[model samples]
Target chain A: DPVTGVFRGVIAGCGYFSRHHLEAWRRIEGVEITATCDSDPARARAAGLAAYTSADQMLEKERPHFLDLVTRPETHLELIRTAASRGVAVICQKPLAPVWGEAVEILRIARSAGIRLMAHENWRWQPWYREAARLIRQGAIGQPHAYCLRMRHHEGRGDDPFPAQPYFRDMPRFLVYEILIHHLDTARFLFGEIETVCAELARLNPAMRGEDRAVITVRHQSGLTGVIDGHTLHPSASGVALGDAWFEGGNGRLALDPNGNLWTERGCVWRNDVAAGYRGDSVRAAQAHFIECLRSGAPFETDIEEYLRSMAAMEACYLSAERKAIVSPLKFLVDSQSE
Target chain B: DPVTGVFRGVIAGCGYFSRHHLEAWRRIEGVEITATCDSDPARARAAGLAAYTSADQMLEKERPHFLDLVTRPETHLELIRTAASRGVAVICQKPLAPVWGEAVEILRIARSAGIRLMAHENWRWQPWYREAARLIRQGAIGQPHAYCLRMRHHEGRGDDPFPAQPYFRDMPRFLVYEILIHHLDTARFLFGEIETVCAELARLNPAMRGEDRAVITVRHQSGLTGVIDGHTLHPSASGVALGDAWFEGGNGRLALDPNGNLWTERGCVWRNDVAAGYRGDSVRAAQAHFIECLRSGAPFETDIEEYLRSMAAMEACYLSAERKAIVSPLKFLVDSQSE
Candidate 1:
């Protein structure tokens, strides 16, 4: 495939999100998904590729140029290790691992093997945030100082709310880990690095195990601060952008309505037209970036080493809620170095 | 005069906010502002009352039944002390005192002298909140669990903003003390007693000595939580309500728009009709309650003892921001008892 100028790719875990990855790889110019693997043969067959129930068997036989790991957080490490030993590059999904120690191990494995790795953090690639970043750089909001995203999703209510993802009910750490982590990553992508985090979490829905509501405040190293007021049990007008957002600056403020329209004091700056794809076709965009970087030998925007900082910030949110104090994510990173 | 049902009153510190108090007092029946006093003779004379440079002189000459203290936070303790010694019940403007110790001393003087004291804390008396309380009690938004107020004010920008209150630029503590304290009081009035407070404070404008922005999170004793996200240097649609608010509950959510209209998921629940006076003429409503309670010998709703909790919560916000940890307002109250 390399001699023929084609980049062959294969995906592990043909679960709910794997469809997006498959479709994206199909659309990219020079990339081809050689096969799909899942523990469940039915799910693997659903991908309509060279189906296999064993990822190791598929990797050894197909020997694809890249592996896309879309499995749950716990499965990520072993899958990455399998790919790394075979000298196959990886694009892994986020939270890298559920806990900090596992995440550090995953990173160490990737670094030691020298395999190209990227975390599939696609929220920042969502057209609205991308447009907001453009306008911010264009002086649309003039020296931005703060950002706020009020996220409301009604799917976490009732006894069996998350029917699509039943595993959501049993998770000890729910909203911040599974959901708001994307916004945290988007915050980092838009505003510089985060320095400190403080959060107040509550479980509004008693049927669920973890906190459903949270007010997370983060201060960037640039002294620009932000708050993510999120609740999964509340009624929201639109789920397209998750919720509405406002980015405040000295001269003006930018607002992202639920319809994915970005507005400044002047008027509507950008409008989101296509609603068919996944979150403004962000998965496709993110996949395209991964493939392009592999071909060009350029680094991924969300390279594994750098993404550990986002993981640390997410860890700090839980720590802040537990200790009822502000926590520095840098401590987690510094401690991880020793490990 | 007691038999004839006339209540004579004197007002001290005839400055900017004093006008609202004076207007409200004039509108209330069976009460007369017999005189006004201020250190600046021009401001004192502007009230169109018999004016004096010394508050003690006005209190002696007028022999009013009550004193309305509309002075700054630093002046509150001395004014309350002066009024209490002369057996003049006082209605003092808030922050109650700039610090907890002086607030305790002010309460001690009022209690020992047996003079009735009420804090003129009136944001909760705003018609929109009154309607919200009614709706919440009516089970419109079922079992409210959280509340959020995103407050934006454009008056704190540029080199010389806040022209009406130039002293605003020099205060060691600006927004939280002078402004957001009202929202905190209203939070308690709407939700319940606050148990813990967490806040992140920032000064967006270099001209101000204190913080111009804050994200304050409070957990109530009743398990309800609220976030007040406020910044003074950003553009907002309306200054009438100061910002917009959302109250989330089990069944639905309640929204308060900038025009003071309250909305539920079904439709507009409450529409604010009158725009005259200060914040829905809440000052007038608050003054009316004070006079009615005085004549009927009923207790003031914001009696010094109860109002202290709101002040303590305000103090806890400052402490939380300073220590970078959650602080309990009860600790401040308990410590004040020993003081």
Candidate 2:
């Protein structure tokens, strides 16, 4: 039986991932959306939760078990720090902060205060990716030497309102931190830790201030090299709609489908041996694991300390892209972790 | 009727394009293959022409009108310079030399000797590219914003020998010069000259010295931007195996197919309203144009002087890849041209 607690929290944003998070929380037993906050009053009220003008007001009125900070990256550190100070455990998004220094600071504060902090790095919990990881561990793909992950979309303009935020639009490290972070973390999750990164960032469209395209090469600690290419400007009809992982090893090539199927090549023939499905219920599974850890005092699978290193890796990529030189994640992390 | 004693030449290497160049030379009437040379002694003797151990022997004994230096890039400059000094007006292959300095010196020597040099930049002669150029000129694609050309091969091992030497294996730039030169030249041919270039080159297999993958973006003198991506590493069963070109204007979008087909989209619908095919036969057509220019004393369509700038652009790409920074082709060319 699940532990019973009064699960009252404030959702500080209503955007792309916010809807999914809100819906997931609603489905979880004993969880209640006590309050919601957004700059747009209409969107905040439309969520059907008790709408509040600000996070401070909501926290004062309804003290909650967890603060689900789904706002833009710029607001993440401040909210998490405030939540930690106010004695609320925090569940922040994939990129803990817009910058690496702030991400470290957030983690440091949470660690010192002994408050639980979970970075919503859902890619590791992604069903397809998890299955690929399992197959890789099972030696289905031999010793992986090289991997490629690509996520591309042609349409840049969208009806989605989240990207309209001033920070999202103005951030120079948009592609590196926003989208590629998931893939970078996924690379770390599958191939141990990234040791070095060399990357190129381009703003293909003149109308956009931030980069819409990136091609990054990561060298892992396990001697596996990988390239992750992300282009938000690619055409939608190009059949490669989702990112895929292609692993080349001594035995043969194993291509992990976007839907979690495994295609292996042996001798001269290729076969899709795995069923086309997710490994399991990813979001609920991760949420359940987090909740279990929170209740039983078991160690969290993806702790804030581990995620801070990934954030440092992303910062190295940004510096590499800007400086046009290879950046060592280890060096960056050493300095970042020192403080 | 064409003038007599203009020049005579021999097809030194015979392969796919050798036959085409032979056919074109035969049609020109004045030119003659006094001899032919192929390292494969069997094919050389079978052609019923006096065969020689080397190009120098062919030049000394046969004294042909010109040397159709159809061999690989490594032999291009030496063969052209030898023929030009012997008073042979030479028509060399695209990518006149393996590297920029060699190409520059070849042009310098050819100019001093009063010998005409023409690079077989044949994409300009392809009817479809010609039509695309016409449409762009006619404002059909408006002021061409960003263009993408993807040239790919499903499967080809490194063992396949062509013409003389295994050009692809020795020079990493062969893939850049032999294949991508067409697209780069076409982009410049249609969109005007390139000003600055930034590129990333990858060799997927370390055993293969040549780069099998490349993603290059150029900023043109016309204030238009473009991207070119090519790889020999794509899956064998991938569909169509061609490239795409996107031209964005104030009005709508115009796209081009790998085989030179054209499509225009305005508001709602897309219309495929262009011809289709390899468009490679334009090599012969372009050669024909060069022959006509020689006969009429008209300026060649692809002037060697003008093409030297494009060669500089190619060199800039190499420098950028090596130095990992943006390079200005014009700045690199200034010293060479002045010298």
**lDDT (CA) per prediction:** 0.87, 0.68
Show the lowest summed lDDT stretch of 10 residues, model 2 chain A. Answer: A268-277
In model 1, pairs of residues that clash are none
Score every model by TM-score: 0.97, 0.74
DockQ of each: 0.65, 0.10
**Quick one: RMSD of model 1?**
1.6
> lDDT by residue for model 2 over B274-337, one digit each (tens)?
2332244575677777777777788776777777877788787778778766577886688787
**Model 1: CAPRI class:** medium
What TM-score does structure 1 among the candidates reach? Answer: 0.97
- What TM value does the first chain of each candidate achieve? 0.97, 0.86
